[model samples]
Target: MPSTPSLNDLRQQQQLAFLAQKTELRIGHAHACPLPPEHLAELDEHASEVTAVLESGLTARVFQLKLAGADYALKKARPNCLVQNLDGQTSFLNELQRRAEIDALRQRHGGFSGIVPTLYGSLAQGIILSPWLSGGTLQDWDERKLIQLFASGAELCRHGLFEWDFCPGNLIDDGRQLWLFDFGYMYRFDPLTQFNSAGQGNDVPEHHLAERIETRAYFAWLLEQEQTRGQDSALAAFRLEKEIAIEAYRKLRLELGADGANGDVLGWLDGLGQQWRQALRGDGEALYWQEGWRSHRLDLDDDIRGQTCTPRTLARCDWMLNALQGNFDALRSSGALAHETIRPERGALLDHYRRLRSQAEDFQIA
Candidate 1:
């Protein structure tokens, strides 16, 4: 039998492939990069350009280069992704398709911070060229900016782009616009349509095209399902938190376009704050993480049982609930929730957040 190549062997092979490239790469960018010249002949000529390394995650070397008055981002596959039929062909096709989907977004030109990358094409050198988007990610943004960041993130999810790794890292802001970068794990799909049809497609929809990313119920099902039984508690908890934030985020997005919803992120969070009301509806213990959840709260001493909330806090919670309800009603109403900016309510929303903190403390004691 042929000896199975070890991981070390694969790494060695990959290094060899990387070294074979003649272009002198520029260093200290995002990751190790060799910007593809627009013409292969040009790359052949200036094979001695300064070396550049990108502080990014291209799975392969990606470099930024300006050729013929236009900027382009280039990525080359490592040896591991180029073996025989295992990871080679499939990963290549996946990335090509992913790039194609991203390029398709050029037609919409939506004002999303994480706007999809513009994929130019791939080459024989195992390089893929995309439009360079220079920007900071969500991790680099502040709280106020985060709301817009979340809005843009939701914008992608709402648009049917299932770039599930749509976190701050993959998102960039080069001052003018925010752009979503690195799409290896992202796929496209229509959740309602896919779930309704039993999900048998070769290609997933882009993140910008999905009707909904996820919600509170999404977590409920996952936590209750046996398939995810062995999943780590931290991961599961994070997923739950993400779902809650996503739910509120979706509502905030619609508010950008003059929808009736208040776009109260905190209000949407209220549903997440109290799982009791939801768990009360069915087999209570099935999905409720009462213990893990209690431990996850802000404090343990505060108790909110039967205590009337301060007017501001109560109003905030009510607004959030209303925002969620409004979004659902809108989605089910006209077959889609219109895309718009997410304008949040300020003072009341702040009060609501504080109250949630208080209630969260109460939640811990429960």
Candidate 2:
């Protein structure tokens, strides 16, 4: 018998249909749109309305638009996505689909406080619009910011939407709240049965909400903290984050269990919570080092794989090389390299990272 098509496969079909113009794709608050479908279809023709243009995004060109006494973000999908991966290619369509899901989730659960509200989206027009969030990206991670982020993440996880990317560009802090505006890398999964949206869901146990945040966003910032402040400062930050994550995961596990989640899922959450709690009680420096190593290694590999490396990627490569050279024994003892198919000797590992660092420099996107 033929295997059933996955949700990803179905979404791809929907994307193709929209691209082919065989199906109309429109969602979100149409009444809140700054312009009609016709105007949005040819938004470039009305350049006078554009206040600013941000072309740095990998999948879309964003325009800050002012019209009828209001400001809005108009995200127009690029003809070709800069990130050379299948996920990047379909990101625009995936974003639209996730937005629709999020809209429904909001209606059912009142609202997701930290997620940005989509004003309008049209797949055929290759555009998405949301209110212009007036705030800068995060420069510091205080207790409040960490709490808000983890709360938002837990909420998304409960609703079965696994957000893959939490990079700086996708987040905004509007004084009052941290807003997650990007959905391009977010995917669907069974919160009651899976770790994340990757593969068979439970198969990739290493990929979870905290891991995604740490790997994609937190560790990069922590690297700067380590360089400027000291190892102690970075370790302190990691401990704080893990404490918040522990509570968040505990609450999440109870919620999922109450909603009839299976034993396996509950057990996984319990394991994570217990591990962190133990580490916190007994000087979490080793745990911090291990997770930092894993996070940087995974994120560096992701950048190289997507061919979207930046200077930050080179920095992460340097961190990994330094770790391999200076702390190879500790890294091995911590079981951080246990996941590798073949454990590389220290020399081989250094050579491997040096090559990756060169590749990162070559593929700098900005």
Best by lDDT: 2
- Spell out the clash pairs found in candidate 2: none
Over 1-366, each residue of candidate 1 has an lDDT whose tens digit, in order, gives 986564334534554464467333321223323343344223422344313436344245565666555655656555454223323323443455566665556456645544555444453445565666665444333333434445655555444455434434456667655565666444454332331111242222211211222221122223334234544543444344444454544474444333332323234334343553454455443233332222212111111332322332233344334434444343223322222122233344345446565674443310
Q: After superposition, how far is residue 226 of candidate 1 from its true place, in Å?
A: 32
Over 1-366, each residue of candidate 2 has an lDDT whose tens digit, in order, gives 987665567666767666677476788766778788568657773489988887768999888889898988999999999999878888988899899999999998876899999888988788899899988766667788878888898999999999999988888888889888899999989998888888668877899989998998999999999999998899889999999999999999989999889999999999989989988997787788789888998998899899999988988989998899899988888777776544457887788778879988888886
Candidate 1 segments whose C-alpha is farther than 4 A from its true place: 1-51, 55-58, 68-71, 82-89, 108-113, 123-125, 135-141, 167-169, 175-177, 194-248, 252-366
Question: Per-candidate RMSD vs. true structure?
Answer: 18.3, 2.1
In angstroms, the error of model 1 at 151 is: 2.9
Q: lDDT for every model?
A: 0.41, 0.86
